[model samples]
Target: MAQYRWSYTSLQGKRYIVGLFHGPKTGHLMIYVNSKIVQIDFKVFEEKVYSFFLEEDLCEITIKKDNGSYGYDFQINKEVDTPLNRKRKAFNKVNRNRIITMFVGLGVFLAVIITFGISQKRKKEREKERYLQEMLAKKTVSATATIDSVKWSGDQASFYFKFYEGDIQRARIELIDKAAVDLYTQGLPVLKGDEFMMTYYTYNDSTSLKLNEPTNLQLANFMYRAFEQEQKSQSHLSEEELRCRVKCAFRVSGISGLADVYFQAETRESNPWHNRLTYNKLVRDIPFQEAFNEYCLPQ
Candidate 1:
């Protein structure tokens, strides 16, 4: 095997630089910087070289055989400085109009930002006023009309409130707690379908207030119970028990995308018993999760 040293420097302050490495057919190359893996397509090896410019700094590089995770070699190098003349020449190419245009562009951006800030502030004030007015109206209504009855369906794990007047114009429900999201993925045959389901209501905005419309009530109840049980049961439940409980709670709602394989398990009751537990046994992955674990998480 052969090795090479590459150098890069930038006068543009700082920016992230990335590249890939490809070589002769002995599997593929995995490029890692500071112990994080970067992608370099193996099929591109026919062209032979993969490199890119980065800001001047020390960087770690690791080359490993693909298809297998453990076979690899690594190195680190510092970017060396070069003559600043070329960088100065590039900077000087800016003419009078470009500077003025850039300033004007910046001014417009600032104006837009200020305008947006004012609009948002006004909008928030309006919302607050509207909320206060609604509260006053509700108090008046409640004093006269029958108070809404909140019915809790234990099986459904949700309180269903019915207002006697004006079509029950207001409702609010929320669930918030600290918990680590556990994901279980298994492959499914391409001939069938891939599926995913989450146990909790996804909160985004006021527009999504009607989450109950698409939510599987049965699954919600199951998941709610499961969550409660998980919290109260044993402090040291095995990963398998946690996985089983979560999978038992969640069921596939639908499927899309044609890829290697797909399956999801969560704590919800929307799917068939055994089928929701089905697995085609394929590798599951996510880039950001791995990145977070590798770069940001404490060891």
Candidate 2:
């Protein structure tokens, strides 16, 4: 039940907000200019076009029902006014166009920087590999390592593994390839606790996976289930009630990617916040209530 809102500015810099409202309950179509209703009509169908003049420019507002939310089309002086144009003229007026142009230029500049950075990173990786080859002369160690955790920083991934070797400060070795990624995961998206015998080379304080490439990495099945859970939990309700929530975020600890969980309780609507009560099962099974409303809903 939202009215389609738009605004226009004349050549003399006079601006006015134009709103087209088609009430579903009242079945009335109304056009408002500067918050004042200029035209009203009764209609059973949802499609209509209202035309008016703003200064010397002819304006047209079209309300056509679509599968999604209704499409509201606005035009002035025979040319359709897109949302981008409306935003540029209505809200920003003077500085938005400049800011937008500068942003586009800045984006191009950042793209160049990112390309340069990737080239440098790959070059450094190659140099390190070459140095290892020169000193170690293709020597490799085969050891069984239990996957501790896996983490990703952009396209590069680091795998933390545990072995009986005395040096146990969780040194990171990035050898990203599809075969290695498939070898460690426990059929879950973020694979851990799996054991595999891998050949590696050590240089100074860093380790590298020999020549194998990691590829064909697919995300876990839980993503679809999580999205379904979110949608199912979004059913609307009329009244408000008490809700309690528990939330957690993944935190890096030593080498384990364990969760840092938080708990809170709030009194809000059933659609946005759960109306059912929740308890802090860890701390003596106490019910968390409205007093703890600084909550996080998992959405």
Candidate 3:
């Protein structure tokens, strides 16, 4: 069977199929045109040329030496080195390169996406492990603190507060970490002589320094507005009824981190939220909103 074949169309629209059968050991060379034998040469060795005519075009098949092996080339009318043929060869080469580049680009994009996904998964796993460790090492206890002193330094202020929780009575200074100065004005919105409740974060095994409370106090001013509205609406009520209205307003406002602010008989001394700067700021102007003047001062 012939291993090499090519098809061509002539200028006059005639079609021809060309095939070559060559035996390297026997040196038997044969050419077929349209399934019929056109040429045969026995004892043909390394190279040979066979030419034929179809219509007005002269076609040539050349078996040439290529490196250590031999190969064949076909051309029509001496058009192998023409400008149009050279341009066609170059265009085909560029198209092949473009196809290869497209596949390579697709592969790189998929690799980047997979790498990003793996990195995100590992980050989340690390975060979960860190959270578990923190939960194991942390201890939370509710405590009462009275603001004994206040000092302002740059954008931050330090508070010397007295904490009395269980059998522990200690004077604490807080919110002065180097990494966080903006958080100073948040949770402990207090002045001298003011008091409030806070959660203490510490370790059971150590008497060392620990966090007093969270510093991200998201103050809800709308609660005070609602309280004022409730006061106005219940102005005509009796004294006890008005007190109930105030209590209701306070309870409703405390839904957001300020829940323990209301005056309960047993817990009144420990819950001085009404005397803190958060409640007193309604009566003071800006820049002095955290002043010591508590308008809703508890007697």
- For residue 171, give model 1's deviation from the true position in Å: 21
By TM-score, the candidates rank as 3, 2, 1
Clashes per prediction?
4, 6, 0
Per-residue accuracy of model 2 over 177-290 as CA lDDT, tens digit each: 554543443122444654445554544444544322222221112222222332345335211211122211111110111110111132335212121232123212322332
Task: Kindly list the per-residue Cα lDDT of model 1 for residues 1-299, writing each as its tens digit.
Answer: 33343433344654343333445556465453433455445543332333422343334554545553323233224233433434444556666568889999999999999999999999999999999877655444331111122233432222222222345444433221112111111111211111122122113212111222222433343344344445344348664554343443232222111111122342225422222233222112243234334444457
Lowest summed-lDDT stretch of 10 residues in model 1? 178-187
- Alpha-carbon local distance difference test for all models: 0.37, 0.51, 0.57
lDDT of 2: 0.51
Cα misplacement distance, residue 216 of candidate 1 (Å) = 38
| lDDT (Cα) of model 1 | 0.37
Q: Which residue pairs of candidate 1 clash? A: 219-269, 249-267, 249-268, 250-268
Worst 10 residues of 2 by lDDT: 254-263
For residue 15, give model 2's deviation from the true position in Å: 0.7
Sorting all predicted structures by lDDT, with the top scorer first, yields 3, 2, 1
Task: Indicate whether candidate 1 or candidate 2 has the larger lDDT.
Answer: 2
